[model samples]
Target chain A: MAKDDDTAFDQAGFDEALRRRARMVEAVLRQVLEQRPLAGEIARPQRLIAAMQHGVLAGGKRLRPFLVMESAALFSADGEAAARVAAALECVHCYSLIHDDLPAMDDDDLRRGQPTVHKAYDEATAILAGDALLTLAFDIVADEATQLAAERRAALVLALARAAGAGGMAGGQMLDLQAADAPPDEAGIIRLQAMKTGALIRFACEAGAIVAGAPAAERERLAEFGSAIGLAFQLADDLLDLTADAGTMGKATGKDAAAGKATLAALHGEDWARRQLAGLVAQARALLEPYGAHAAMLADAASFVAARNK
Target chain B: MAKDDDTAFDQAGFDEALRRRARMVEAVLRQVLEQRPLAGEIARPQRLIAAMQHGVLAGGKRLRPFLVMESAALFSADGEAAARVAAALECVHCYSLIHDDLPAMDDDDLRRGQPTVHKAYDEATAILAGDALLTLAFDIVADEATQLAAERRAALVLALARAAGAGGMAGGQMLDLQAADAPPDEAGIIRLQAMKTGALIRFACEAGAIVAGAPAAERERLAEFGSAIGLAFQLADDLLDLTADAGTMGKATGKDAAAGKATLAALHGEDWARRQLAGLVAQARALLEPYGAHAAMLADAASFVAARNK
Candidate 1:
C-alpha cells in the first residue's frame, strides 16, 4: 500500500473515469435491450419493448455501475464482465425507482427531470416494464456473453438475487411504505435506508469482489466499505432533498419529510447530518486505505457521493 | 417407443400422481417462504411476507411444478433438485397470477375461492408481493441448495428470465391489455396465449430437462411437449370459464368474453374448441410415447388436463 503522501487524489480523474465507464455501460445496456431472442417463437411486443426501452434508456449518472467498475478494478477483474454485472445492478436500481415512483408508492411523476415510467406510460405498462427490467437484470448477469466462470456467475446471481429480492431492496421498500403509517425510530429508519438503498450499493461492491475472486477477508472489507458509502450516499441524498429544489435535483424535493418519514437528516439537523456524511466518507476511505492507489477512485467515489449536487 | 396396444393409461393413477406432486411442491414452497435470511439486517417485514404467503399458499393444482418434476423424471434427475426447481417455477407461476389478478390488470376480487392478493392486502402490497415472489424464484433457482452445476443454474436463471420477461410472459400481458382496444385475430390470440401462459409452462418442462442434463434434442422435445400441453391448459381454462360458474371455478366466469378478449373457444365455438383440445391432448400424449410406461403419468396428465372440471 502506497502512503497517502505519495500522490494527491485527483477528483477530475475520477470524474473522467466515471464518465468513461458510464458510456460503456450505456452501450452495453442498449445492445442488451435490443435483443429479440424469441424472434420466431414470439414477435416481440412493440409497446412492451418500447416501454422497457423508455424505462431503461432514460439516463442517470450511473453511479452504482461506476462503483462496480472501480471496485472490480481493485483486483483487475475482466472489464467486459464487470460492465455486464454493473448493467445488471443498474437495471435493479432503475426498476426499484420505477416501482417507487408508482402512484401506490412515492406517486412521483418526475424522475431525472422527465416523466416517470407510470406517467409516460399507463400504470399497467409501468408495472410490467419494471417487472421486465428486474427479470432482465438476472438475464444479463447469467448471460454467456458476460464470460465469467459458471460458479462465479452463479455466485454473482445469488448475491444479486439476495440484494434485490425480498430480503433486501424490496423488503426495504416495504418497510419504507409502512413507515409512513408509523414512523420508525432513528435506528429503524437507518435500517430501512440501509436495506432500501444500501443493500444494492453494498452488492455493487461485493459483486466486484466476487467477480475479482478476492479472498473472503478482502471481500468482507470491500463490503464494509460499501456499507459505509451506501449510508453516506443516502444521507447525502436526504441532505440534498432538504437543500435542493426540483430544478437542481431533477425530481421532487423534500417529499420524504412531507410524507412524515423519519430520516437521519430529518431526525438530526442539517449541520449534524453534514458532519455525519463527512465522517462516513472518511471511514469509507480509511477502509480502502490498505489498497492505497488501487482504491483511490473508490475513495473519490465516497467523497463524490457526499459532495454531489444531484 | 411404446406400441399402441402396449397398455392402457389409467386416469386414477394420473390423479394420484398429480396429487402427490402437488403436495411435494406445496411443502417445499412453505419451507422456502418461511426463511428469514435477513433477520438481523432487517426485520422480515411481516405484512409483505404475509402477502407473499397468501399469494403462493392459496391452493391451486400446481400443474406447472408437476410438469417440471415429470419432465425431469424422464431423465431421472435428482428428485430433491427437481423439487426445488419445481418450487421456483411455482413461485413464478403464483407471482404472475397475483399480478394478473390485480385491479390494474384483471381486477379480480377472488382467486382460488379467496380474495385476491390486492383484495386481501392492497394494490401496492399485491404489486410488491408479486415482485418479491418473482425475485424469490430466481433466488431459489440460483441457490446452492438446488445443487446443480453453476452453469446449469445460470442456464436455468437465463431461461427463466427470458420466459418471464419482455419476450415472454410480461410482454404477452402488455399485449393482452392492449387487446381490449384492438381485439386480435385467431393467430394473434394464439400467439398471445402462447407467450402469456405458455412461456412459463414451457419453461417448467424445459427446466426439468435442464435439471436432468438432458441433451439439446431432448430439451427441445420436452419444450415442444410443454407448448402442446400449454395450449391444452389454456383451452381447458377457457372452456371452464365458459361453462363453470364462480362456485366451481373459484372466480368470476366468462370474463374473457365480457372483456371482448378473443380466446379459441370464443373464436371457434365450444365444439371446435373441444375437438382442438382433444387433438392437442393426443398430440401431447404422442410426444411422450417414446418414454413408454415411464411417460404413462404424463400421457394421463394430457388427458386429465382436457377432462378437468376446474
Candidate 2:
C-alpha cells in the first residue's frame, strides 16, 4: 500500500475503512478453512484442526492480516494474493496468542473478552491447539492456496516460519519470560520488541507483497512500513494496558502492574512513553507516503495507531 | 499392507532386520540434527530449536522416520528423498513424543529411559520445543529445500499436516483422554491404533514416494505398507509390555498394565495378541512384494516388524 499520510483524509471515514477491511480478513479466513463434511470419528491429530479453528474464531482485532491486505492493496494488487497471505498470517498470530496465554506462560485466563484456550479447554488441548495452529499455517501454504508462484509461496512460508519459530516469536517469548525480572534497558527492549512483535508483522507485509509480485524495492518499502507500524502497534498496546478497561478490552486490565510485569509506563514513565508513541505513529505515517495513492488505507491505519483504546 | 496368513517369511530373520533398521533410523536422524554454531545470543526460540534437537537426539529406535526411508527405498529411490523425508517424519514423530510426555497428559517422568521433555526442561520449554518441531516440519516443506515440485510439496505438507492434525494423531489423543470409560471393543482398538500409530507412518512412506515423484498407485501401495506395519508395530508394543525387560526395551515395562490402560494383551490375552501379531507381520511383509525388486528393502523392514523380539 502506498503509505500516504492520512492526516489529510477523513479521520472517521478512514477508521470505517479499516473496519470494513478487517471484516474482509475474517471472511477470507472462514472461507479458506471451509471443508467438506467428514465421515466417522476424527482421530487425535485431527482434533488440533478443530482446536485451532476454535481459538482463532474467538476473535481479536484482525490487525496483522489486515496489514498484509492493506499493504497488498497499496500495491494495487487484487485481494486474492492478500487474502491468502493474510489467512496464513492470522494463523501464526493466533497460534502465538494461544501459547502465550497458557498456564505456564502469562497465565492469561481471558483474551478478547473470552476465556483463554486453556480455560475453555484443558492445558493439554491448549498446548496441542497452539502446536496445531503453527503447523496449520504452513499446511495452508504448502497446500498451494496462495496466489503467488510456487517459489514465492515457499518464500512466504519460510518467512512466516522463521519469524514464528525459534528465532522469532518463540525467541521473543523466552526473552520476555526472562526479562520479567527487570525490564531491559533501551537496547534490550528494542531487541525484545524486534523479535516478539516486529518479525511477524514485517513478514506479513513482505509475504503479501511477494504474493502481489511487488518489485524488490516495493517489497523493501513494504517491509519498512511493516517495521515502523509494527513497533507503533506494540507501543500503543503498552499504553492501552495502563489506560484501557478490562471489560472493554475483553482481557485483564492493568494486569501487567498487578503481576509486577514490566511496561513502558513503568520503565519510561507514562508521559514519556506517550510522547514516544506519538513520535512512532508519526514515523509510521511518514513511511506510507512513498506508496502514494496506494498507501491511503495504511496511512489511516497509522493514524489509528495512536488512538485505539483497546 | 494386505492381511496375510501365518506363513509369510522367516520370523527369526525379520527380527534382526527391525533391530538393524532401527539403528539406521537412529544414525540417519542424528546425522541430520547435529547442531551448528549460531551467531549471537541465540534467542529463546533458537533455544527451542536446540531443545527440540536435544530431545529428538536423546534417541529412540528411530523407527518411524526409518520406516519412511525404507518404504521409499521400496521404490528404489535415491538417498536424498529418503534422507529428507526421514528428517521431516522425525520432526513430527518426535514432536508427538514431546507433547505426549508433557505434565498435563500422561504426566510421565521418563521417556526412552531418560527424563521426559517436561522433566528435562520446564513444562513451558518442552511445550515450545514441541511447538517448534511441529512448525519446523512444515517449514521444511514450506522451505522445500529438496528438488520437489510445487504440487508435490503441497501434497506432502497437507498429508503430513492431516496425519499429524485432528483426524490423525490429535484425534487419537482426544479419544484416548475421553475414551477412558469406553468399552473394550475391537473397533475401538482399531480406531485408536489408526490415529495414534497409523497416520504418521502412512505419511512417512507416502511422503517419501510423493517427494520421489512416485505414481499415485505406487503411493497407495506404500501407504498400505505403512498401514500394515503401523498396526503391527502397535501390537508388538502391546505384546512387549508383557514380555520385554526394561534394560532391553529401555522403558518401564508393566506400566500399561499398572495404569489399567487398554491394550490387545488386556483384551485378547497375551497369547491371542501374539498370534494376531504374527499374522499382521506376515501381512506387512507381503505388501512390499508388489514393488518387486524395488521391494526388497521394504520386505526387510516388514521382516523386522516382528523379528525384534521373536
Considering every candidate listed, which one attains the maximal TM-score? 1
Identify the runs in model 2 with alpha carbons over 4 angstroms from their true place: A1-11, A28-51, A76-81, A145-148, A181-183, A245-247, A258-260, A263-265, B1-47, B76-78, B181-184, B245-247
- Cα miss at B187, model 2 (Å)? 2.3
| Candidate 1 lDDT, A8-115, residue by residue in tens | 356688779889999999888888787465432365687877777787888888999998998999999999999999999998899888888889888989888789
Q: Write the per-residue lDDT of candidate 2 for residues A1-310, one digit (tens) a residue.
A: 1233432346687767767766777786676454431221244333455566778876776778778888777767768667767877888898888888988888888787778888888888887777666666776665655556666666676677677766667777766876777767777777787778888887776766777778988888777777777777777788788777777777777877776667665678878766776677677777777667777677767656656777
State the local distance difference test value for candidate 1.
0.85
Task: Please state the error at residue A266 of candidate 2 in Å.
Answer: 3.6
Worst 10 residues of 1 chain B by lDDT: B1-10
> lDDT for model 2, on a 0 to 1 scale?
0.70
The CA lDDT of each predicted structure is 0.85, 0.70
| lDDT of candidate 1 over B100-191, digit per residue (tens) | 88767878888888899999998888888999999889888888889999989999998998899888898899889999999999889998
For every model in order, the fraction of real contacts preserved is 0.65, 0.51
Residue B136 of model 1 has an lDDT of 88
Q: How does each model score on TM-score?
A: 0.95, 0.88
